[model samples]
Target: MSATTQDAVQHHDHHGPEKGLKRWIFTTNHKDIGTLYLLFALIMLFVGGAMSLVIRAELFQPGLQFVNPDFFNQMTTLHALVMVFGMIMPAFAGFANWMIPLMIGAPDMALPRLNNWSFWLLPFAIIMLAMTLFLPGGAPAAGWTLYPPLVLQTGDAFPFMVFSIHLLGISSIMAAINIIVTILNMRAPGMSLLKMPLFVWSWLITAYLLIAVMPVLAGGVTMLLTDQFFGTSFFQAAGGGDPVLFQHIFWFFGHPEVYIIILPAFGIISHVIPTFSRKPLFGHDSMVFATGSIAFLSFIVWAHHMFTVGMPLAGQLFFMMATMLIAVPTGVKVFNWIATMWKGAITFETPMLFALAFIVQFTFGGFTGLMLAIAPADFQYHDSYFVVAHFHYVLVNGALYGAFAGVFYWLPKMTGHMYNDKLSKIYFWISTFFINVTFFPQHFLGLAGMPRRIPDYATQFTDFNAMSSIGAFGFGLSQLLLVYIVIKTIKGGEKATGEVWEEAQGLEWTVSSPPEYHSFETAPDIK
Candidate 1:
């Protein structure tokens, strides 16, 4: 082609995004889509946050004060569902969409249009899920596990819940496939697998986990659908179907689902800690291996969640040992983070504060997890507030905090302005303080033998429950500060340079702040 003709084509391709809603609806730009995912997840954070407050409110004095028992159960069930699928997963996806291509020096995700479709599916799925609460029997209240017999009791909400899950599973798998293909096929020259950023590597592993287990979850729920509507007895004891079989299928997916929510958080922490510490990651290659090891161990340890339901002694022992073994690699990661910070110029930036909290609180969660891993001990902990405390620490303080850190760390780059540091710090301290107040007391409540999912509790559980409820209210309100900071950053603030953080490293920092519409019209050379 002539030079003039070639230049025209290049100019057309490099034009800015279309104006108005059409750009968001039809554009395949990764950054635009990433923004959409982040905004959506933020909205969900509030939605799920509201539901949690209702739960804490009811449990405050434990006399069925704010909501009825059935509605309270709905709150618990829907809160978990929205937070897991809506809030955390999509927030991580936002990170992947925005950062992966930037990190790997790729122009865009390998499947840009598929990326659009994957995200679009989520709102529809969430709508279906939320609509269930108004349905004849209220939303699925068998807890997020959606175990049968009990879940089978759900009314018109059953089919909605099932199909919504199917939509979520499909969305997750597509995103995973896109991430896998992008990383494997689109990395710039010299950006080998081993050289990829920790965040990129973590997402790569997480995508694989998503692809592997989402189908299992989809199948489990599909069976539930069939059993409910099509006369299948997959879990009906009267029809010779064992309910325990469903537990096996659900936890097979559920166990790894925890890692799926968390591994990306792990990735974010890996990046944030090193940047603030002004040090190279202490053990980059070992971090990668430990991540893979955790993923592998995640699969074998599902049975530990099922020990209370009954299993052969040998089966229990195998699962118990496998669960405990995960600690080795997890401990390796913790040590690596600590080592990276040891003897370095560490500054407690807002991002660093959240990351440090993640490491410390997540370790607390992990220890509790280990305690639950003992098959003998699990029999006592099962279905109690203790179990609730363990996972919340991992999810809220661990995964959610990691997401918060990433937002602060990258906000400057994404929006071309530095966030309000003072407000952010205040937000951080309040959130941290309240999150502990909310979940830590649950550990005590569980030890005191307070069963979970109950609307009213024994008088003996009142003091701790009241404290937890107060913390829950404080934590939920504190999140509004995040919304304010994000908006204030986007509208206007002190301008940020390409390298937003002093020690920031990667292809992303090499680009202009709030990188150009196409990110990279030409691929970056990674040396």
Candidate 2:
């Protein structure tokens, strides 16, 4: 290594984690707090995943075998609530907390106290949400979408759910703002915008999207509360309010919410693909432009979700076309990944396997999305198992797969121990195969006219339901390996070097394994 590189490594060695649990809990240090956030998110993933198992088990047969319709609704609502708020979003934040400063060669996040406050709010919020399950009316049955008329019909648990959502929204908004401030203000002295890693760029955009949309959700839910308690008619048709308006506002926030979840995954894959391919990222500028275009388009496509709620032909056509336009940017990203991998020396590490799966699976999900984007065709597919199948592919195959890849890719660096490679591959293969088995058949069932949100199905759907259920159980069981791998790595394993992957490049690689509590206390020279 050159004199400059040697000097950078020495500078990094001077700063590492300070001792104790107090440091973790009360930590303003980015790496410490980042670990806390990640562990919390992983715990919530299992909690949320367990809830999905219940939903799947109930829907396993043609009838409600495990839960009543009301409780089933609670399971569905909480499953989505936990997954979005408790799992995926936090996981991305965890990534931000850990990787952002390291990638940018900053000492820590911009505002550290606020970081602790933001994470602390999550556990309390989820607990409040879970408490609703035991309440008199057995939790809010209005689904995670939480539309008005039905939401108003919910029991005492409704207030708790509302409050919990408020807490989550607050947590998210705070995190977003912190990230924005950090990236804008804390880059190393010489690092310029274009010189930053793609992950940083992606997150910078995502944080803005979060800040822009979360308040809209807060406003929508607040309106629901007023319509319920204050005798307002915001969504009550009887009092000259339109219930459909709730969907309008909700989807306005909701559409952008989808981009918020997936964009980080895009950033991650951007980082991972080039590393494994031994090439510079193909079309880096285009990838950045594509991500921005997708975020902009997200705002206008909200109405596509409401096509069946009675929109004008022109309105429908406009939404369908705009929604379809998202495909161009998304397609650009897909092509970029393929080009990055073209005839390159690629290795199937756990992370790479998952990324490859993400490309194929997310594309399939995208195709299904395109099918649904059509106003006329959506009329048939609306509220069907097909919709469920589509999102699961995106969420499970896309977001969750990306999360897995990230964990495996970074495990060595984060824990300073190499995980069991054999077990990691087993985890990947089983998860990939069973995930498809679990959700793929639902596409056919949905196309054959199976409606979603129903407690039971017709006899004709029984065989596919059984197969899907079995797949669900298999998928759930396979995750145990993931838990085991993480636990084992954290406890002890083969020692890892500073550069976890031989091909890895970036400021993060300059730091030792299990990076310092206050990484980059002195900025490193990036060139």
Candidate 3:
């Protein structure tokens, strides 16, 4: 055997993972922490999915059958919070934990103890968030945006929710710092920034975005807390604080927050499309530049979300044009993916299927977003179901679907067991088709003037709303199949090879399937 192989084994496997529950609570291993992040995200996925079901059921017949308006708002608020905070973002972080060090030829994150702390913070934060629901006056119902005046009046859930958000923000900041430090300092010799994998590149940019913006969210929410208790009037108009200032601050964080959830998805797709297409990623440098541009643009487009808030015409025009400008870099990404597929020996694995669907559906969301970017056109779409449909298309089909693609792409390697191909494809098809059914009609309803965040609507909206509810249920059930498929693969199935996908590029595929508890003991030279 080569000296290098022996050295790798000696260095990487010196202390493998400990056994049982103690292994989890006290572990500093990156793989272990990544697994914890994923498991937590999975559990949150179901919890948030349940909240969505409540919403769908209530909106099913259009008369609020199951929940009253207050509870209905609670469902909406919690669903967005849990899904965005608890499910999507952490899932990406989980991927970062599991794959980043391996991809960069590092044995572990730069800050392993901080990694443990960041992940552990989530469960407590989630518990605090959940606790808010059962205590006194129910969960915060001002939507995930948590705009002021209305937010100040929420029940017992308010303080807990704010505190939970603070915990989450702190956790996110720590995780981002770990990612930045590891990516910057731990890469193998000969691996320069330009040569890094797209996933790593995507992450570096996202970490910066997180570091820059999450504090703003924390501060905004803190001000809300102060308004609630300390008698500050940061958002109270009667006290001379303009409520719109809160929108300005919140969206500053909020818009970038959307990109934080999505940039990793771009990284995931960059890898997946290349693997299935059996070719190098097209426009590799361009993808990097485009990602950077998107990150930069995310900072300036925050105001587009508040076009209805009565800003000056000049401010409106500036934000309107800035929001539309984002489409350029975003469009470049979409173009590169398709170009990567062009003239390649393509195969439609489960991951590729989802990737292809993401291109179509996510672009659809982008188009709608552009429509909403027009200051004039937004006047009509603002606060309507159209806005609702637009974001879900992006979040659910874009971020969440991209996540599904990544998980499927890496599942075999992670589990060392090939999932049921038939079942995986079935899960994909059901999820894609029903997701459209669930959210597509909302576009029509919004154009027909159906306002969002309301429990009941006019009779004209009944048919579409019922169809959406049915689709929501179907989409919700489809996820169970994914959960089952994941379990079945992990328990036992066909063993996966070191290179799980055909010609899957990067240092990660060079590692063993179900890589050692401590991966990459010795850094690999990136030739």
Q: Residue 189 of candidate 2: its Cα lDDT?
A: 81
Global lDDT of each model?
0.94, 0.89, 0.93
Clashes of each: 0, 1, 0
The digit string of per-residue lDDT tens for model 3 on 1-527 reads 26466766576457767889999999999988988898889999999999999988988886757889998999999999999999999999999999999999998999999999999999999899988889888999999989889998888889999999999999999999999999999999999999999999999999999999999999999999998899898999888898889999999999999999989999999999999999999999999999999999999989998888888999999999999999999999999999999999999999999999988999999999999999999989999999999999999999888899988999988999999999999999999989999999999999999999999999899999999999999999999999999999899899999999989999999988999777766677789
Q: What's the lDDT for residue 489 in model 3?
A: 89
Which order, best to worst by lDDT?
Answer: 1, 3, 2
What is candidate 2's lDDT per residue for 1-527, written digit by digit as tens?
36466557677466444576676767787777777888888888889889888888988888668889888888888989999999999998998999999899898899999999999899999999999989899888888889878898888898888889899999999999999999999999888988888888889999999999999999999989988899999899999999999999999999999999999999999988988888889998889899999999999999999999999999999999999999999999999999999988888888999999999999999999999999999999999999999999998899888888888888898899999999999999998888999999999999999998777889899888877878888888998889899999999999989998886978888899988655676678767
Better of 2 and 3 by lDDT: 3
Off by over 4 Å in 2: 1-20
Of the two candidates 1 and 2, the one with more favorable TM-score, higher being better, is 1
Residue 263 error, candidate 3, Å: 0.7
TM-score of each: 0.98, 0.96, 0.98
Model 2 sits at a Cα RMSD from the real structure of 2.4
Model 1 lDDT, residue 203, Cα: 99
Lowest lDDT sum, 10 consecutive residues, model 3, at 1-10
Error of 1 at 36 (Å): 0.8
